[model samples]
Every structure is written in C-alpha cells, then in structure tokens.
Target: MRTMLVADDDPHIRSLLRQVLTGEGYQVLEAADGLEARERLEAAPVDLAILDVMMPGLDGLELCRIIRDTYDIPIILLTARQQLSDKEQGFLQGTDDYVTKPFEPEELLFRIKALFRRYDVPSLDKIRIGRVLIDRRNYEITAGDETLLLPVKEFELLAQLAQYPGRLFSRSELIERVWGLDYEGDDRTVDVHIKRLRQRFAEHDGSFRIRTIRGIGYKLEAGNA
Candidate 1:
C-alpha cells in the first residue's frame, strides 16, 4: 500500500485524517509537529503528505519547501488561514493543493485522488543513463547483471545529482538540500559521500560519471542517457 503522512499538532485532526485515510486503503503516518514529519520523511518514501499549516516547530509552508527540495511526493496544505495571500504563499512554496480548516473529509480525499491521477507516473522511481540504472523505489542499483544496494545517504546524494544532471550544486547548497540545513557537520561531509560514491561506481564499471567542478560541488554527466 502507498503511504500518506498527516502533520498536525491537534490530536483530533490527526486522528480524523488517519482514520479516514486508512479506511481508503492508505498507510497513514502521523506527526504532531513538523520536525517529526521530517524525520518520517527521511526514514521512508511517502506517496503523499497532508500538512496542517499552523503547527509548532517548522510551519507547513516551510515544511512544504523542504519536501519539495528533497522528495518527489505530492503535498496538500491544511490551513485555517483562508486569505488569498496565504494561499498564494503556500503555492509559491510548492504545495500541490490546499484545504482550509473545517474541511470536509470527502473533499480532501478527492484532492488526494486527483493528485494520484495526475502524478502517478510509472517511471518516477527509475533513472537510467547508458549502462547504469538507479531505482529510487527499491533502493537498488543495476550495473549490467550485478545489482547493488546503496546506503540511504549515498543513494539520495547520487539521485539528487543524477536528477539534475549538469547543474553545479555548491557544497553548502548540497549540504542543505541533500542532508538538511540542521546538519552540524562541516561541508566536507558531501565530499566524503562523493568519494565513496565514486569508488563504488568504479567498482561497478558505471557509465555515468559524477564530476567535481573545482571550487563548485559536483554534477552528473551522462554519456547516453
């Protein structure tokens, strides 16, 4: 079953969303605040997210931006603020849909289904460039007949660079985008992961190459993607 997350500080709202979403055959993950929601996001792949706008910790708009930056999941914002400006800001942050407070459960369900209909692309999980293949859903990499499982951090870093091939991501931008800004470690952590990735790809005789841009970070150069 596909997973859905509801990040709302109110117990009643969370319970209501969970019960209804579970009844519709989705596995619902609940978070009382934005931090927990982000933890859950890092831990697994969620198909969709329903976020309450006025939560403690990181508010929904910010959370939406973070999710958009890292994950491919669709997001729907739950808010009591009905102002046009508020809705515009939410959209500017990359939310797919918005549901104001005191919303009908059926309406939310309909929106969720509509998103599935729109973005449920079959190839969203897989990336192939020449002899290399990365499956984001299964966390598996295929090089010819040999298949390898990559650690979560390494896999995410590779996927991020591969998705935006030729884009030069700075070290700081990569750290904040791939590993979250809360990471206290120095920017060299990205260098470590990149070194590990390069070693692994060499062992597998991968076709695509991740090239370092001197002072800039890295970019993926696929020969015949």
Candidate 2:
C-alpha cells in the first residue's frame, strides 16, 4: 500500500484529508507541523507528501525544499494564495503540484493521481533500507551526513537487493537483473561487487548488511530486523 504524509496545522484540514485519502485505500500519516512531518518521514518511508503552506514551526515551502534534497517522493503544496508568484515559488521549492485552499477534495485527488503517474518510472524513485538511501534518481547513496556515488554496476546491484530486503536472490538471478541477461559473465562478478559494497559501508554496519547464503546466493538484511 502507498503511504502519504499530511502536514497541516489545522485539525479540521488534517481530518478531512485523512478521511478522503483513507477512503481511497492509502495509508495516511498525519503531522501538525512541518517538524513533525519531517520526523514522520525519517521514521518511515512515504511515497508522497501533502504540505500546507501556512503551517507553523517550519512552513511548507521550506520543508518542501528539505524533502527534495533528501527524498525522491512527489510533493503537493496546499495554500490559500492564488497568486502566480506563489505557485512559482512552490514549484521552485520542488513541489510536484499545488492546490489552493477552498478547493474541492476531488480536485486534490486528481492532482495526486496525476503526480503519481508522472513519477511512475523507477529511475525517478528511491529505496530506503534502514539508514541507507538508494537514490536511483541521482545515483547517490546518503548514509547519515555523508553522501557517496557508486559505480553503475555496484549501484544497480545494491539498489536491487535493497528493493526487497531479506529476500534471497540467487547469483544467476542477480546477474540477469543487474548485469542484464544478454551479458555473459562469471557469477563471481556478483561476489566482487557485493564485497566492494560491504567494504564501502563497513562503518555503517549497524544500518544494514549483505548476507551470503553460502551454496545459494545472497540477501540484504536490515540491521534493526
């Protein structure tokens, strides 16, 4: 199920959106302000965010910018302003769409659906495992305060494994997925890349680990699990 974060200061607005969003089969996470929204995002992965522009303790536009820098989720800004300049600012802050206040719930729903369709490409998404973020959009990994870019093959390998944490993937299956089925190569190539990933993330061992299944293949395990 897709998860959505609703960050708005008004209780009535949050309750209304919750009802509408939940009725559509989406899991909803609520926050009274931008700070709580950020905390919710860090605690759990969300597919999209809906932020209210007039929120206290961190307005929507600033929070939108922070989310753009860290995550690859679509954002829709809700505001009372109808000025063209206001809409432009939201777009510049990385919002995918906007809905002015006194708007119909149906209109907001349509905008959300449109944004999801636009970002349906996997390359525009991100996979988060524990503290590690595999950002296919930028081909970067953010672990705590440090960000690193891996080689194409290495990044692909990790991203694939992280996509299904704790799911076993045989060497042949991995090669076909990451290296492509047409490429003829030794299965040990998988081992080499896995080794490099482990070495590269040795310091962040508490976050996640790549486990070798000995005779079978490998699987990624979240440290907390």
Candidate 3:
C-alpha cells in the first residue's frame, strides 16, 4: 500500500486529511508538527508528504528543505498565507505544489493524484549530454566548468527533455508533464521557459541545443561524437 505522511499541527486538519486520503486507499501517517513529521519520515519511507507551513517547530518551509535535500519524495506545502511569495518560497524549497488552507478537499486530492502519476513515470536524476550535466535532485546543471542553479520549473522541464534525447514533445505535452496535466495556462509559458534554458546553454558556449519544431514542440539534440 502506498503511504502518505501528513504533517500539520491542527487536529481538525489532520483528521480531515487522514479521512480523505484513507478513503482514497492511501495508508495515512499523521504527524502533529514538523518535528514529529521528521521522526515519522526517518522511521520509514513514504511515497509523498503533505506539510503545513505554520507548525510550532521547524515549520513547513524548513521541513520541506530538509526533505528535499535528503530525500527525493514529492511534497505539497499547505499554508494559510496565499501570497505569491509564499508559493515561490515553497517551490524554491522543492515543494511539488502549494495548497492554501481552507482549500477544497477535492482539489487537494486531485493534486495528490497528479503528483503520484508524475512520480510513477520514469525520470532521470543525472543526465549528461556532451558537456552539460544535470542533477535533477540537486537542482543544479553544469556545463563545462560552470554550474548554474536553475529555477524549479526550468530544472524540471530541462530534465524532462534531457531524459529522452532527440525525442519531440509537444508544448501541450511538456506543460502537462512538467506543470501538471491540470495546469490552466497558455502554451507561451513553455516557450518562455525554453527561451530561458537556451540562454543558460548559450552562456556555456552553446554546448547543446534544444531544437524547436515549428507548430510541433521541442527536442534536445543528441550529443555529438
């Protein structure tokens, strides 16, 4: 049975999440705070984590950073603060999604399912094409002697393309895979990210190219011999 760890100080929130996730056929593990959550995580591995941002000790943001740095588990940060900066902080800390408090249970469930689907898909943690080396877990991409820290979305998109060199992905497909299938956004989002990635590669002597097929999508060129 797949396990999910819920870390929140609120009794009602924990109970509600436990009930909902249990009904969805997940083995639910509950923690009262970030400290307890860490203990639970260390005791055993879980497939995913749902963390509250305002815990008494360690807090959700700090916990998310610890989990991300130590493990590859997907995390959803729950916060009462709905500011864009809050969401950006969670993303920078390696959270897969940010859920505001007072959110619909169904929405949370949907996000969890989306994360599961993505996690089950095959991915490459370390991909090397020519001089560029991508460590997806560390969120670092290196070309030649220069190492760059990529924004969350850029790293994920690049990793997806690097996973299958020379394979084409439609803009819609890339958006679905990297940004979640339920993401409601313009295809221009993909284009903008690709543009940024190209700039990063160019800074390192243009070691590799991400090919754009007109009206199609994008592909990472195979490494030259």
The candidate scoring highest on lDDT is 2
Q: Highest TM-score: which candidate?
A: 2
Ranking of candidates on lDDT, top first: 2, 3, 1
C-alpha lDDT values of all predictions = 0.85, 0.88, 0.85
Model 2 scores a TM of: 0.62
Candidate 3 segments whose C-alpha is farther than 4 A from its true place: 125-225
User: Candidate 1 or 2, higher lDDT?
Assistant: 2
Q: lDDT tens string, model 3, 1-225? A: 678999999999999999999999999999999999998876654779999999998899999998876566679999999899889999998999999989999999999999989978867679987888999878998888889898999999989887766555778778888999789888999999999988877755445688887887887775462
On TM-score, the stronger of 1 and 2 is 2
What lDDT tens digits, residue by residue, belong to model 2 across residues 182-208? 988889999999999999999888889
User: How do all the candidates rank in terms of TM-score, highest first?
Assistant: 2, 1, 3
Candidate 3 residue-wise lDDT at 46: 70
TM-score per candidate: 0.60, 0.62, 0.56
Better-scoring candidate (TM-score), 2 or 3: 2
Model 2 steric clash pairs: none
For model 1, the run of ten residues with the poorest summed lDDT: 161-170
